[model samples]
Target chain A: MEERKVILDIHNFSIAFEQYENGFKKTSLPTIRELDVTIHEGEMVAVVGSSGSGKSLLAHGILGIQPYNATLGGEIIYDGEILTEERKAALRGNEIVLVPQSVAFLDPLMKIGPQIRKGKKDKASKEKLDGIFKGFHLKEEVQDLYPFEMSGGMNRRVLVSTAMMGNPRLVIADEPTPGLHMDMVRRVMAHFREMADNGAGVLLITHDLEQALEVADRVVVFYAGTTVEDADVKDFEKEENLRHPYSKALWRALPQNGFQFIDGTQPYVKDLPEGCPFGPRCKECTAECKKRIAYREVRGGRVRCIHAV
Target chain B: MRHHLLFIGKNLIRMILLLFGVSVAAFILVSVSPIDPLQANVGQAALGSMSVEQIEKLQDYWGVGQPPLQRFLAWASDFFRGDMGISLLYRQPVLEVIKVKLANSLWLMCIAWVISGVVGFVLGIISGLKKDTWIDKLIKGYSLLIASTPAFWLALVLLMVFAVWLKVLPIGLSVPIGMEASGVTIGDKIQHAILPALTLSITGISNITLHTREKMIDIMESDYVLFARARGESTWSIVKNHGLRNVILPALTLQFGSISEIFGGSVLVEQIFSYPGLGQAAVTAGTGSDVPLLLGITVISAAIVFGGNLIANVLYGIVDPRIRRGGKRS
Candidate 1:
């Protein structure tokens, strides 16, 4: 219960970018719409989504890599303090590091040692990173080798080392174990679990539900850029408690659960349904579903489906 | 070290082919010219009185009477052995004439080379790291402006502005044109080279600026750069350590591609400043149709090109390890 203390509190966050054309008229595309999400210390939150679910955009928001042209509407508080631009740069790489998808994540031309040592002057960063590299069975000599010289496994280890070098409180991994072998996935997942145990929040984003089920304490399922389901991993296991029609449908759509594929496409943000974004594709849809966005809460979880109550 | 050597060997092969192609074209162009050096040596008065026997003998002496391949091979062999014959225009040993000029040109070129290379590379990285920001826009504007303008035109403009308007450096001549009795000392000669060297560098420096900036932008988008950022690396570290190094890959590999430009710049700069350089010496040889002098200059130019490209290749191979690993795919 003490661990539930908020590490990040993002409220009503919206981001829009202006596009210019035809000699100067500009229009905005609102990507994130009133998104409210939070993460407590030592938590593992798996962001579940299909492609283009705005998962990466959320990561960009947290890291402040969102372009200057982007108009952000919301408060992002880190440790009870409003996260400003100066804090964003300072927090990045040390306070909230990222582990992006590709194994070739380290610079192909530079050696690992100097690359890892870069921009990090703090104590916890250097020591913990050195420990992780040694713990991962990666040799110290590898610091001299270029990214291309390292094997896929070695590169994976080196990437984890570099991210941990900052000893960040939050580690956002976008499909961390994608394209990796099954053996490597377990090892990577174990590393994430160890990180969370050591007081770092691990935000692992992935489309692979089974992997998420393995390591995540809780999960937030994104549908059409909206969090349709937020619940403990156990809440996802119960057949009766799979309350959201979308969540139930998603549960049914799992290959292991005997369904081949989900029946329809996600709702377009621009041409979204008046009520639930999933209403168009939901088998339990009714005429009343067209009036408002779905919002419902089960005993131990929340879902954005009207009929779920 | 082993990989480095292997890359050097591979690069040497490529340089040899490139130089061979260039040398063949140069040989044909120089040989088929309208004015023959032997005829050039003998004025209009001697031309009418010269016997057919003497004319053939003169042609034979210059090896023009022999088959093209034979003459080229003989010339290449002797040229490599430091026997480039004599200049018909200067009436001096071709080696003796070109040596001092080549030395001076090399010195000026070397300085300009270091300056442009270092500054362009560092600026390129900075621009890429600040992509889409005002800093990036400013560098992009500067690079484009420099790249699009012609070198000689830029030279004249700079001369008028810096030398005439500001009076910082001398103009038109290299080191007191009278030729001091002891022949202008090394230090004075260098002081005289400033304007011409700067004039020679405009295009090359600009080209380096644009090219490195563009290349670094491509490198910044690379996965590794993203990876570096993900690792919590600072902007400066990413730009310097990651962006610049990878961007320099193609630059390193294709380095010899610019040697011809440098030599070409030297030719123009020499004429503009009236400084005595091997490039202008070659031009003087060509205009006067000095056969031995012409051959010597042509051969030496080819050799310098060959040598420069060779160095570029060797250095490239050292920087890029992939070339050493599989030999070709990289």
Candidate 2:
């Protein structure tokens, strides 16, 4: 395979929030630690994890829109340049776009047309938005209505249209297909795939691995706030081809793989083990597993487990 | 547009019915009181020397000799025709008495209302943006202090300081006594208005400030605001365009309730400064058992309050698209 140009490169990323525990006794709660993910030009990368895996935080961190108390560590590079706060502010909504998870993210008071156009009243912008809306099956009159005047599915379509309206080079879609029917989910995933085919780097964050594998070029599995494995879609064809123990477990849990179940839950951030976050639940636990493990490339795939063959 | 018009029409009818109910309640309450308008108008010495025929003649002149229901009906009919009846104390037409004083009170309260609203909104935004910081703490402390302190006492203290001690403002009244009513300049009205307006504004400013602060903080944390930030919108633009609309819609509803506070606060503040507004006239009517004057002021006040609320609802429809569009389908 030809080496594609890197559009977004995130390395050793960490996110911690400063919170008041009890009456001004402050503590730092580290949610994401030592995370790494990279998106290449013309590629759709899916970051798949269950709830509490901090997948959404990675999107917010990339956008520089993290909450005020959240302290971010490590570097994020966009097109070979350091993505500083200033650069993020400048490029956001133009070069990079986020399809947010909640329908509530749409301003209830604002009309759909102006919001998608970002208040641009010019003829060309309006025409372009109308085209996008038509593509999404939204009526011309829907632009005059408020978010509260629309259904949840309609609002989600509007959100997708918002990202489509902008000529963004990178699209971060955070659980964009939830509550959607199977056909609608496939349709939305096809939109992301189309964007990647047009050379935009797309990061599709979802917990549904089955759906992700249908569209994504690469799958980065997150477990307990850290990346456990980065494998191509072909690697997910069989459990043996996957590198991480957790990834193998996840693959076996799929209905096609006999629906094998893991016993323990992913530990909370406060109770996370020192080395491998999945150590407590891994069958290959040893004394060496208690020490910090670095993500290493094995068989052209990245894995965090040392004993991966 | 047609739906909005129908909604407004319905609200107007409701307001009229509310005024009728208020008139009936006010008439009953005033009629059941022990004081007699005839006795209140005539002195105690004159009452002792007067004959029964003279007393009956006095009651007839004052229009209190009729049954309460009969009197109320007559007054209501006359009110519909724009005749507010006659004041027993001032011995003048009630409408005439209220016209000038009502204008003066409206001007004073309007100024106070505008000043307090602007100041409160700015302070609220600041406190909300800097929540849990020293600036927010100071604003909270100030609002708490003002809320706890009585408006009347605050007026008196302000009166003593600004008028008597500082000698910077006029002591009492809406205008100087000898100036021609037409000749009285805006400067003169403002000079006399400063203390009373400040007195009326303190409690309202504090109330609105705290309410707006709480509302803005919640709105700033809302998902839409975070989304806007992620869209690369500047903080000021987001606050002004998005945050203020949501915050001020609820604040506007709270402001309509403050109309009653303006009237209620004006009574004491007007009496304290001898400012001749409707509140002072209402107080004088109460003390002297001037039944027609009291009832007239009550009707006018009820009309203003109802009108204020109607205006607020209309403004609410204009500000909130959800209400204007009659909510979402499914």
Candidate 3:
């Protein structure tokens, strides 16, 4: 296969929140630790993780939209350049767009048309919006309507349209299909797939592995706010192709893979074990796993487990 | 268009019912009060010197012999017909007294209202946007202090500072005491109004500033605002495009709601300032047993307050398209 350009490269990203605890003393909660994800030109990478595994925080971190109290660590490289805070601000909306998780992200008082257009009234923008609305099966009049007037499916489409409004180089869709039906979820996923096909790097942040496998080129599994595995979509077709024990567990838990689950829930961030967050739950966990495990390649896929061969 | 008209009609009917209720309550309260209108209006010496027949005539004129309900019905009917009766204290028509008094009060109240609304809203936005900072702390502290401070006490303080100590402005009244009504310049009226208007505005700011700050903080933290930032919207752009509309609607509700508070404050404020506004007339009528004048002022003030709320409701539709459509479009 030809080497496509790397559109976004994330390295050791961490997010910690400073909060007031016990009188006036402050403590930092490491919500996301040493996470990593990479996307290439015309590729969709799904970062799959359960809720509070900091999947949403990863999206916010890349966009520099993390809350004021949050402290971010690690570097995010976009288009061969370091994406600093200033660069993120400059590239956002025009080059880097975020398809937010909920309809609540839309301004309620604003009309749908102006909102989707990002308040653009130019003729070209208008024509482009019309085309987008039509492609989404939304009536032209839908633009004149408020978000509260639209169906959940239509609003989701409208949100996708916002990312399309700009020719984004990177589209980070943070759990974009929640509260949507299976059909709607597929439809929304298809929209992200189309964006990737159009040559924009699309980061599909979701928990549903089955849905992620439908459109994503690679799956980056997040465990307790850190990436444990990054493997090709084809690698997920068979459990033996997966390197990490967690990936095998995830594959086994799929409905088609016998509907099995491992013991112990994902640990809370405060109580997370020293090295591998998945150590306590992994059947193959050894004393070596107790030490810091490096994310390295094994059999053409990246794995954070020392025992993975 | 039809929906808007129906809304207006509904609010108009509501306002009328509210005014009627207010009028009846004021009439009943005044009737039950321990103050004997005969004693209050006529001096003890005059009452003792008056013949038995004269005392009965005075009682008849005051409508003291009639049932409270009967008097209210008579007053309500005459009120609807535009005959507000005569003011026993002013010795003039009740409408005429209210008209002049309302005009003066409107000027003072309107000035105070605008100042409070504009300044308070801006301060609130600044405080909320800069939450936890010294500026936010300062505004919060100021609003808290103002909120707890009595309107009458504030009015007295202002009166002493501007009128007593400085003596640059008039201490009391809407116009100069020696000046004829026709001769009183707009400048003179404004000069005299400064102290009272300041007192009312200062007192009014705390409520709007505090409420709007709460609302602005909520907007700043809202998911939409966060998303807007993610979309690369500048902080100012986010405020203009998202925060303003959300905050302004609730702020407007508080602004209009403060009309009653302003009017209530005006009563004590006018008393301290000795301003010849509706509040001062209200007190005069209340003390002097001028039933017709009191009822008229009560009804008019109630209508003004109701009218303010009606305007606010109508404005909500203009401000928010969802309300304009009567509900959510879907």
- CA lDDT, every prediction? 0.73, 0.87, 0.89
Q: Which window of ten consecutive residues has the lowest lDDT sum in model 2 chain A?
A: A148-157
Q: Model 2, A172-266: lDDT tens per residue? A: 99999887788888887888888899999999999998899899999999999889899999999988899999999989989898899899999
Candidate 2 off by > 4 Å: A122-142, A149-157, A164-167, B1-13, B24-84, B130-141, B179-183, B326-330
- Model 3, residue B302: distance off in Å is 1.1
**iRMS of each prediction:** 2.2, 1.1, 1.1
**Candidate with the greatest DockQ versus the true structure:** 3
TM-score each candidate.
Answer: 0.86, 0.89, 0.94
Q: Write the per-residue lDDT of candidate 2 for residues B228-327, one digit (tens) a residue.
A: 8778778887886678768888788878867888888888899999999988998889877777788888888988877777778878877887776764
- Against the native chain B, what TM-score does each candidate's chain B reach? 0.79, 0.90, 0.95
Error of 3 at A77 (Å): 1.9
lDDT of 3 by residue, B73-107 (tens): 88889989989999888889999999999998999
Model 3 lDDT tens row, A1-309:
789999999998899999888859888899999788889999999999999899999988888888888999988999999999999888888799999988899999998898777676899999999998898888998898888888787888889888877779899999998877899898888888998999999999999999999889999999997899999999998999999999999999999999999999999988999899999998888888888889999888898998889
lDDT of 3: 0.89
**Residue-level error in angstroms, candidate 2, position A261:** 3.0
Q: CA lDDT of B231 in candidate 1? A: 54
